[model samples]
Target: MPEALERTVYVVGPRWHHHAAHADYAVAASLACQLSAQVKKLNSPIEYRWLSRALVRRLLTQSKGEPNYSLGTLLTEIVVARHMWRRGGSLYHLLYGERDRTLARSLPRLFTRPVIATFHSPPARLAHKGIDRRRLRGLEAVLVVAASQRRYFEEQGVTRVFVTMHGVDTQFFHPAPAPAAGPPRCIVVGGHLRDFETLGHTIRLIRERVRGLRTVILGAPTRWQQSLYSAGGGSVEFRYGISDHQLLAAYQASSLALLPYQDATASNALLESMACGLPVVTSDVGGVPEYTGSDGAILCPPRDPEVMAQAAVRVLDDPAYARERRVRGRTRSLQFDFSVAARQLLDVYATVLGDAGMASG
Candidate 1:
């Protein structure tokens, strides 16, 4: 394939907003939009075409292994694969990694060019299970956002792996003027793997120590889920299906960000909150520490309410210390800027395409 002709890169994944309740889809959407903008501004010889929900039909048969899987998804993969196999392309990028066993193996055989899988992750359980490994079999490269994921994939004998940190939109999530003097407020964002039981416990403990501290839970909790927090001592507010503007506003107004997750991989809320210069108290699990850095935020063991509560109080009680953490966090966020990641990703694209002439550039 000519370098010029192979400039278009096809991306396959769930629609970024396909699931309004899931934060991962939002991250997928943000990445697609940002990466496209960055590549265009650089006048790079590449373009990304995304395919997700529209590609697959919602078939009920896949409910057992893939409850979310659809007939459209399966057909689309074959469609894209057959197209690349018959015609020609530089590479096929699977953003959600792999969908199913048969598709993962067949897609590669159907493509003459390299197949690059990115933006994929499963809970530690799913990835380790014998079934999902089928998805990793035929790929030219795998891009991960978390260190733990990279390690996990490598341990499985997969090579040519890369780690890309999640990027933050500083312009959107930047710090704002502190809210009117009142009780300090904290926020819990994102629905994936969040441990609300731990959150309730931590909030109760925090309210006992910190006077007038309030919390806002955005994303994931239905009215029944909201009822689980009956023991709240501090004020607790819940909001669902809010706009990004409203979410960012919550981040800016809050003094601390709480992300007590039960399981693996990345957290979009962690990056957005830290970018907004809010202190974070998150579970010390998976790739979270990769973003939070050693000193940027407070890390506590998962399901431990007492330790998490103490960490929150420490940040809220010490204004000077909290401010320092905020400053450090914002500085760390800049390193993961989309532009830098875009350039690096372009290099990966060039390398995987075997464009020796352009890869060196």
Candidate 2:
């Protein structure tokens, strides 16, 4: 390690430029904060630093409309690499690689150490080709959020694979007393890549069967809102950007959380819902089961709206079952603490650094 003042690790992730605000990609931002804090508390040789997302955005503003538009990410990587090149004693950590898919390939040479990265979704390329290989290269390990992703990475022979489940701030998401007068309700959250088309069908199912149920859909984009406008005859509330406090209220007021994702590799909303003592009913695809475990949340067949709706209704209608689920949900959330994720992540850094040391020696 370099002198104490120079020892550091660099983290690159989504650009949440606001004053530490919680945006759609805030899950990674929060986890980054946790990791940084833990590293500081340990008083190790390395310090944690984040690449300036704002700097990247400002420098590449004209390229915002570029096709696939990864110029900002590319510039960020180059900037960070140059910075680390000058600093000479930092490890590169890609917090999802942001949009720079080729980050790993370039980072290792600059840092003189293997780069570590996490993936939120599968590789975009259907088949690995020229640039795809570099895009997937240079990582010491690729940490995934669930076993399903690990399986995919192993099958494809990617770098080292590890399961790192999503973490939640239990203290921030703890349960509130259920509103005494509100009708039985369920919450729908997540955005962009979610299965809103299927969620529309699920809402219809809920309307047909469950009486006096309120369905609050949070963070539904214009496309989703337009498609789901007539859904449930307006019983379904399509809420566009909501605050964290509002989201917590939605969770605490609900009987269950519904996520009809076409596919997933662990969900931030699922973890948050359970952390707030809300049971969940989501599609059983990808890493849904990994997050739900055996009993915390009910899992239904994907694309089957009726089954998903029925599961939510069952959790809501049966007081005894909901109570059991609440207990299980909170218990499950406890197991996914940030500390657990931090331990595993720090271990990966240690291993990578040790391997680099051995090779150098």
Candidate 3:
């Protein structure tokens, strides 16, 4: 029997920077780091290497204003691909596919190694940002956070498309020891694709119906603070740059997770909230229903403050219903643990490597 060639997979993506001390957050921003960590524990033949952060920063700075399809971006990708070629890797995975679409499609021609990419944006977001189908056809595989996004890639003629559900750190975000005794409070976290206008309106309506209803908005941009505060009818509290312990504490103390989104794929806020045993009421847009399903959350139409507010009030008024939602949400979150996602990703890596080897033979 011949000795098998060793396999190396290089992970390329933006640095997982968080203000909190803990690496775990509800958003998929930490996917590269979390996924890499899980892959390491499996003790498989595949070895993973991260592209140097200094190199990434240099490339990002060069392509600051125009990150996609620009002359600078093209040069950046070429530089990165050539660097990897010289460094030597059996395969390459681009964690943020949007940043390196051109590289992903062209790598196979320039080098014999297989390339795969994971895309986080929904179809509408992708369309708005602009993606070239021709540039993406070269990928060995495409991984998406939501099932709804699979069709876009398949339509573009990419043969292998997989839906890898976003994962959360369940142990860190676990529920409180017991419900806190105080006025009902709701938490809103993260600002990406969030409908702040509708959130302000919904909070106002929620306060009118439920007395002593406190709302906390975390990670909101400083520019929008005044408007949100005024719209929240002076019952809103804003916090920023807090550590992970504080964040987990906030989730545990809150009564419900009230999130309104213009569009979404997979939300860290929703998953983190559910894992913390906080009931969720969020918008029913792209991939939101797919993650929450019928029982996991109370879904409301986008930009409809009245409907959102009504749902919030209902959860606040009925203890039994709120408890039911909390139980269902935590149960649902177990399905998205980081370990599960790591196993699925490992399988994809093995299959891609096997196919690549057969092609060469």
Q: How does each model score on TM-score?
A: 0.81, 0.80, 0.82
Return the candidate ranking by TM-score, descending. Answer: 3, 1, 2
- Model 2 clash tally, residue pairs: 0
What is the C-alpha local distance difference test score of each model? 0.66, 0.66, 0.75
- Candidate 3 per-residue C-alpha lDDT over 222-314 given as tens digits, one digit per residue, 9 for 90 to 100: 888898888767888999888788999999999999999998897778888888889999999999998788988999999999999999999
RMSD per prediction, one decimal?
Answer: 5.8, 5.9, 5.9
Cα deviation in Å at residue 37, candidate 3?
Answer: 11
Model 1's C-alpha root-mean-square deviation from the true structure amounts to 5.8
Question: Could you tell me the lDDT of residue 267 within candidate 1?
Answer: 64
lDDT of 1 by residue, 290-337 (tens): 877897678899899999999899999999888888888888777665
TM-score of 3: 0.82
Model 2 TM: 0.80
Name the top lDDT candidate: 3
lDDT of 1: 0.66
What TM-score does candidate 1 reach?
Answer: 0.81
Segments in model 1 whose C-alpha atoms lie over 4 Å from true places: 1-7, 18-67, 98-103, 128-131, 223-228, 355-361
The 10 consecutive residues of candidate 1 with the worst lDDT sum are 39-48
